[model samples]
Target: METTIYHYALCVSLTLMLFFSYRFFFGRLPDSELYRPYRQSRRLMGVALLELSANYMVHFFITPRAVCPTIAILMNLCTYWLSVWLFGSAMMLLLDREWVSRRRFVRHIVGWVAYCLITLVLWFLLPSRVSLTALPIVLAIVFMAYAVRVARKVFLTFRRTIRRLDDYYSDDGAAYIRWMSVFTYWAVFFGAGQGVFTFVPDRYVFVWIISAIPFYTYLYESYSNYLLLYEKATDILDKSNDADAADEEQQTAQNPSQSVADNVNCELNARPQLVMSHDQEVALERGIKEWIDKEGYTVGGLNIADVARATTTNRTYLSAYINTHYQMTFREWVNMLRLDYAKRLMRDNPELPVAEVARQAGYLSLSYFTKTFKDAEGVTPGKWCR
Candidate 1:
């Protein structure tokens, strides 16, 4: 009865794996250049899942008692290593594309090859039963160590990237980094669970099946989130491109000679703008300040383009104006406004929670808001209020 139950669970897990693997390979993946790395990672994950399912099927269903234990052990070891290789490749591409070059990829391949060759030679020397039973435990321990190391490295890199950004709420690059961090954490958790189950194959087969349901469910949900994020990123890019094109056309229509000069200056000098007369500059600055004051746009994910659109100005001109008048980049200027607003909110409603104050101040993340507040004011929001 126990064997029957385990067999049924394996069948169900295998079916689900195959279905998702098919979806991953043939599903409507995002076509935007921004999603290229994400798409590649999904493909690698699909291949790994397929190999893992095959490994389980062979171990449970195909390996008969008459079959040589050495052959079964070797096959399982190969599949285990292959799955790890595929996952590691996917993560490397996702977290650090620069590190996924041909040289690094080849190095990884060589390392895996050497490990497998050494293990196989050892397997032949050991008794078949010992090799079958003990080798998995050794491999599981090594894999768990690798997973923990990789997870820590990925998390630190992600945290550093976020800290370096002035306005993470509006930066898609920051969002991608955060998402990769979540993926790394999820993969490590599930991979560790699977590794632990490998040690107690007799007692944990049913538990493994139950755990796999949530594991694959989370995997699918993350894939959906990736799709949604891709769509949003592409939409933002399209709008930015359209806005730039429209701005150029309007400028050319209004002042053909000045526009031509500006284009030439932009190509040669890297920062070209029609010299704004004092009156024009003041008017633009006033318009921006009034719009921000009235609309509270600074409370959330404000960008130069958004402000430019609100003020009926070009983004380039608006950015330059902010830089010249405020002595800061657009991001810094927005954060300055947000920080001031948050301080006032805290002072007026002292009873409100710091998290609520952060939200009202347009911060998507409370931890980030606190860090920014401390950087600017030398005290946390809670401390400042007191």
Candidate 2:
């Protein structure tokens, strides 16, 4: 009787937590303008909750001894399939949308289906619970393999994306990456815990309770970090729009005669010109350099969007201006400025430590700083200082 009560209590608590997790995360996103990925996450969560409820109902309400085993096997397989799909979807959404190809997804589905079919076939053929334990152990091994692959892909995607963005070293970006790392590690930990519980069911209860804490904790943290990144992107768009409006107003007010010429040029170049006007490009370049010097933005985490906001220009214009005038990506351009700043600092304060120079120069990683400095200067910071 106590065992039955404990089982039902655990099921009820998990179900309630799932309900709140869904409500807290998905409820706040507006239905009218819901992002497709977020909607998919909500649906996955719903399916997961339904699978849990179905499993609970099968265990609690069904009393027929002859059919209970069969039903249990079916429910467990369904639950496992849903869980795998949910995990795959989460990996694709959180890491990189383009990472998972259609062929890969179809292959995953087929593999999982085969696993489920084989487990069902073996369950009735082999009457021993000890024999059935092998199925879960095999499944756990498969899950761990998949988790490792996803983690590797996520790390590569993160590094590549950071290199493309201007504010890669900013506090928010660092926090976002940290949360993602936590999420990936927790996922691996959960897989290992599941494997342990499968092999040794005696401590299943304790493991389940303990695992739930970190599972939800990291899951929430990952989602929160994703939302923070989304908010930052939205702010950049808003600022860009404001800046464009302000520029147009000022241009119209200051040069009424030139406004007609500007309008004609805009109309002529409405098809998106590869090259910007020489005069306009030069002015933007000068303004950006002056702003960077005045604000000391060479310290890491300085993005083109931040510079655009300060210079009252949009990202489109700033990117084009930099590419045309500087012949480098935003990342390269910023690193060049930072390296120059570091060199100046080293020359002036010969006693300053190399690590301190890297920190002051806006480098988040000492190794990365050392590598970049050596690549640009053809010598280590220490050697350069000497």
Task: Assess each prediction's global lDDT (C-alpha) against the native.
Answer: 0.68, 0.59
113: Cα error in model 1, Å? 3.0
lDDT of 1 by residue, 213-307 (tens): 66776676777676776555445444544665776788789778878887897567344565677887777878887887785554465555677
Name the 10 consecutive residues with the lowest summed lDDT in model 1.
Answer: 164-173
lDDT of 1: 0.68
> Cα RMSDs of all predictions?
9.7, 10.8
Q: For model 2, how many clashes?
A: 1
lDDT of 2 by residue, 1-386 (tens): 23454355556556665664565445666453425555555555556455655555555466221244334444454455546465545655544544456787687678777867776676668756744456555655665565566556655655554433432223234334456566556655664344444343322443453445556555655565566466554344344346446655665686666556656766664312334577867778788878877845555656566777788665556765666568876667777877888899998999999999888888877887898889998999999988
List clashing residue pairs in candidate 1.
299-362
